[model samples]
Target: MIRCDAHMHTRFSEDSDASVHSMLDAAIERGMEAVCITDHLDKDFPQTPDFPAGAFLFDLGNYFQRLTQLKEEYQKKLEVRIGVEIGLQPHLGEYYKELTEKYPFDFVIGSVHLIHGQDPYYRGFFEGRSDEEAYHEAFEVTIENLKKINSFDSLGHLDYVVRYGTHQAEEYSYRKYADEIDEILKHLISHGKGLEMNMAGMKYGLGFPNPHPDVIRRYRELGGEIVTIGADAHRPEHVAFDFDKAGEILISCGFSYYAEFKGRKPIFKRIVP
Candidate 1:
């Protein structure tokens, strides 16, 4: 299969379990054509920048060093790409901008993992906030963050609230939030930002694909041409999970092809199963 999983995470990310070698090995074993290692970098993880969440121990120097060595080591076996997942908070834009300026990433994902300073990975975040409030904040924060940092390529998991919210996918379809969704798609389209097809929704049993296929179609309807499918895999087992389904969603979303990056520029290819 000719496939690329652009959003896999490694142990460098706070919640991930796979290592760079482990993820790449899984991709090679699965016969994937390419893969990107996009570990998380949120400055608020304590003492870094505007984030007080404590410093994350993600070592970029080592990451690049090892990636360079591994790319050379595995070039004939598999193509490994360098990427980073930056958590977007309005307060941390400048830091991220400066950081990316110094690092040449093949892919950069802008995701909203926290709302109002709390991560939804924890349970209580879905408790105190109403479903509407939670969903609204998620969308608003994503839009606000994207607006602030227009430099990134793809907008990650636009419907991520469903993964951790009080509501399920059946209750959280495109019709319920069309206006805001349109605004987001239009903004991204205007800025030429691609959307990410994160298959983690299916992996987590969220019923629909991440961002919901309907929303993806709407994005295409609003002139969105570029997209990147990511399993958002934190473990080897999750790598390229549901990739066929992601491609199907893209085709139905009016996209004839999907994109992968090298040297921070897009190279589009038709979705092949």
Candidate 2:
């Protein structure tokens, strides 16, 4: 079983109302060995008139203060790691670089949640574009960000666009974007960065991980080794969702080990049959 949940959000994340203490209690109840509080930190966020500005940005001082208190409080029962999930954009690459450098984070998950100043979460982004066009454009932007930045530890939810695509993920497959996907994987491998096996797809009813099983297999075949398991949980109950199934998926993809990070270094743990 994957013992550590490396991606989670708390009250610090604008999208979530869960507190750090409540989440820690839930992780303990589920028998988790470790949990990382990776709250959202999306800089230069394109705020809509309705969305307002700096909504996703969290106070670093308050975040660390709460983290330090919780780490000390739960140090005996569960291990807590300080982490951040950075929303990558072409123009904010340098901003994230300085952010990561300024903080002492255990892990960083780089994710692309927007394209052309719009998010796929809303239907309007996919209104005129074909699902194929939308998905491909998202991947293209991912490649652009990956090339421009090298500060994050792993790429979060590689095929994130498919989760919210108008037609859903039924029409998506790795074969359709093999070249672009390969380029992304090659960039990660070259930089010694990792990939995250995000289980949020199950919650979204996609019946697979963010990148799909074939994409994970291809990542392994391309000599990519570092992989972390996370439910991408924003609430207490969502932590470590379908982790056993995630292990099965990893083993089927020829990954005998999943990764855990401390001080920004990956330590692989063997997957048992």
Candidate 3:
């Protein structure tokens, strides 16, 4: 079983209302070994009706202060690690590098949440293009951002755009974008970065995890070994959502172990059968 949920959020994330204490308690109740509080740090997030200017930003001082105390408070019953999920944009590479260096993070997830200054969560991002065009552009931009940044431990959700697509994975596949997708996988592998198998795909009703089972298998086939499991949970109940299936998926993909992080380095834990 995958007991370590490497990605989660709380009120500090700006998008979540769940407090840090509630989230840790829920993880302990479920017998989780470790949970990383990877709140959002999406600089320059575009303002929207639901998400106004700086909606995804948070105060780092308060975040670490609270989490540091809780990390000690929960040390006996559970392991709470400090982490951050950074939204990657090509121009923000240096800014993220400095931010990451200044903080004592146990893990960092580099993700692509915006494409061309527009979030795909909004309909405006897809208004003038076919789903294929939109998806292609997202991947292209992901490649650009990945090429520019190297401060994160894992890439958050390789196919995050599919979650907001018109059909939402009905027409998505690794084979469809094999060339671009392979480039992404190869880059991560060559750089020693990991890929996150975000279970939020199932939570979002995509019928599969982000990047799909095929992509996970392909990553292994190409000699990529680091894969982190996460629920991307924003609330207490969502912690480790669908994680039982996470081990099964990793096993089927030829991964005998999943990754956990401490001090920004990956530790491989065996997946018990």
Best by lDDT: 3
lDDT of 3 by residue, 1-273 (tens): 888889999998878999999988888877799999999999999888688876788888888898999999999999999999999999999999999999999999999999999989788888998788888999999999999999899999999999889888867889998898999999999999999999999988897889798999999999999999899999999998898889999999999999999999999999986
Q: Write the per-residue lDDT of candidate 2 for residues 78-111, one digit (tens) a residue.
A: 9999999999888887888888888899999999
Full candidate order by lDDT, most accurate first: 3, 2, 1
Q: What is the C-alpha lDDT of each candidate?
A: 0.82, 0.89, 0.92
For each candidate in turn, the TM-score is 0.94, 0.97, 0.98
Report the number of the highest-TM-score candidate.
3
lDDT of 1 by residue, 211-250 (tens): 9999989988888888888888899988888776777778
Q: Backbone clashes per model, in order?
A: 6, 0, 0
User: Could you give me the TM-score of model 3 versus the true structure?
Assistant: 0.98
For candidate 2, give the lDDT: 0.89
Better of 1 and 2 by TM-score: 2
| Model 3: worst 10 consecutive residues (lDDT sum) | 46-55
